[model samples]
Target: MSQAPGLGIPGILHTLREYLVFYSGLGLLAGVSLLWSVLALPLRLVLPRRWRKQTGRWVITMGFRMYLRALSIMGACHFDLKALDTLRGESPMIIAPNHPSLLDALMVISRSPNLACIMKSELVDNVFFGAGARLAGYIRNDSLRSMICLAVEDLRRGSHLLLFPEGTRSNRLPIGTVRGSIALIAKEARVPIQTVFIETESAFLTKGWPFFRKPSMPIHYRIRLGQRFDPPTDVRGFTVELERYFQSALAEARLPPLSSMGARAP
Candidate 1:
């Protein structure tokens, strides 16, 4: 393949466009997150827990939806998330999506209101996300007992729980070891488990992609609803089954060319 400079006008213009979108997208995300955090700080202090959960999560969903729209409008990427809309207003359940990228949770959370997410311990205190997440009543993974209780309580209160089964991004192909938390939560809450597959054609934010590097555009992302498993009686067995299901389902899924992907995962 010819380098951008060698290809002249068209290639140069494409390169320039990619760079522009790349920086703009990252900037928009950081700016919005910071602004939301600042706005949420006061609300968290004033609003009751119930009001905060309702208003905060709804606000987050709309914000993420708009950010995604901006990315689409900017020609940075493409999204096929219509399938998730089908689950709206359905009974409370655990949404389990494959952890391919950091963006996976945002994709799910953006489509629904009042979805309680399990945030990374560090992110719960991150300047960009801490206040917003706390306002939304999102659970943190630092304490297992506390996390499970909070997650179960969220489910019992008619909120969808957004917890990645892989616990983190997949460093291996298909998936990482499926954690038993999903099963434990489902069984304890007596709710169903709705699986989702996030397929992408570029490794822009995968397990080991550089923050400053940009992927070739236009990247395509599609989220498809997978098997809906009822609450299992056996947690260990269910975890084994869930892992197998992901491995089998994603064995032929269209992931990016990860071998040549750049730098470390966030």
Candidate 2:
């Protein structure tokens, strides 16, 4: 009999490994979220307001850390996130980064335990994720003034604000236009912006990507710490400069394509 292209022992084993890693990644994410939901309910009732938010943030961080660890152990992904550890000793500030994939937030959160993320209103109201996010005191991005006030409060409470300056993922390469929310929050809170650059080669979870789609194995992701911008006095000017900075910084990064339209702004 003739030899088949992908029917050999090693090829079959490779295919099996990919499937195992892919599904396990999905399952682990849901597994952690569901587990957190169950645990958050009673904790909310028992703990005080401050304690609840603190505990919620800690547990979410640990859960994400473990999930990423599982993926690493399974040879499914490589995470170079050590750059974020240097910020542990720093004071509360906005942790700004480019949103490349859905995993962008996951990567940052897994490393920084005290980050208060800005979530979309709908996601904050999601049944599966709402409980934990609500309990964690994550800021919602529906109302501008409310979002800014809550973000400043979180910073005042000594939690790093996790803000994606792009506001959403870049549909094309390099980056999308940076929004003013980051600068405004920093100015109002009097906190600096700790810029982070997340570089990845996979398109697994970019905007509009399929939920259950399987990607290639051993996806490599690297995060680099960028310039720290002072609390801006000029929101509009800072927003313009911020976009230019991202355009210059990520000019060489291998960002995944978020859409097939080929570089149209959202």
Candidate 3:
């Protein structure tokens, strides 16, 4: 007997399997993450200052990587990265990437081991990322001076610090303005800035979206690391230069500028 004209049983079964795996993984991750956070709280409060924070961050980061791997195994998404060698075991460096999606932060951390980030003040209160963020000693984005100081100190202590120069997610379709804060931190710490750009086609986990929808098509990410440049002594000049560099990179990637989408400069 001939098969039906539409999707075959095998195809349908495959699709359903993929979906089940994706959602199930997400659910499992949520449950385990909650338990981990709760357990870490008391340890965070009772353990010695240094060890407590370090242990807590490691737990969160390792958990995050496992979650990402689960998603990859489900074939929900994939990433293409260039210049991976540059990031291997590099520390005392300010690694900056364009912020286009909420997942960008996780992507960066997953790629770089022993990495800390400059996160927003609101993240400090967020249940999902807050506890771990505090334990990791992520620099709060609210205070420029304080954040810079913290970043410099992290670098001094041999920790890699990742930053999003745009400060927030891009409102535009493409690249966003490069805030001067990153440049300032680089200069103050006397470190070179390692630039990275990420391009993703998945709209499921976007800038402000809360719901998860499986994409009709597979999502792909293109991540490239640009050459490191010495921080410019001329702060304003460096900002303009970095902004143009980001714009050009996005353009080359065939993506739109964040400014075109009404994204404000940070």
Q: Considering every candidate listed, which one attains the maximal TM-score?
A: 1
lDDT of 2: 0.86
lDDT of each: 0.89, 0.86, 0.72
Model 3 regions lying over 4 Å from their true place: 1-22, 81-85, 208-210, 254-266
> Residue-wise lDDT of candidate 1 within 144-175, one digit each (tens)?
99999999999999999998998988877778
Task: State each candidate's clash count.
Answer: 0, 0, 5
**Cα deviation in Å at residue 66, candidate 1?**
0.3
Candidate 2 RMSD to the real structure: 3.4
- Please identify model 2 stretches exceeding 4 Å from their true place: 1-9, 261-266
TM-score of 2: 0.93
lDDT of 3 by residue, 88-143 (tens): 67657888888777778877776666677888899777776677677767778888
User: Candidate 2 residues 1-266, lDDT tens each?
Assistant: 12223778988888887888799889888877987887887888889886888888888888889889999899888999999999985798999999888888889988888889999999888766788998898889999899999999889878899999988877766788788889999999999998899998888778777778777778889999999999999999999998889889988887876656434764
lDDT of 2 at 141: 93
For candidate 3, the lDDT comes to 0.72
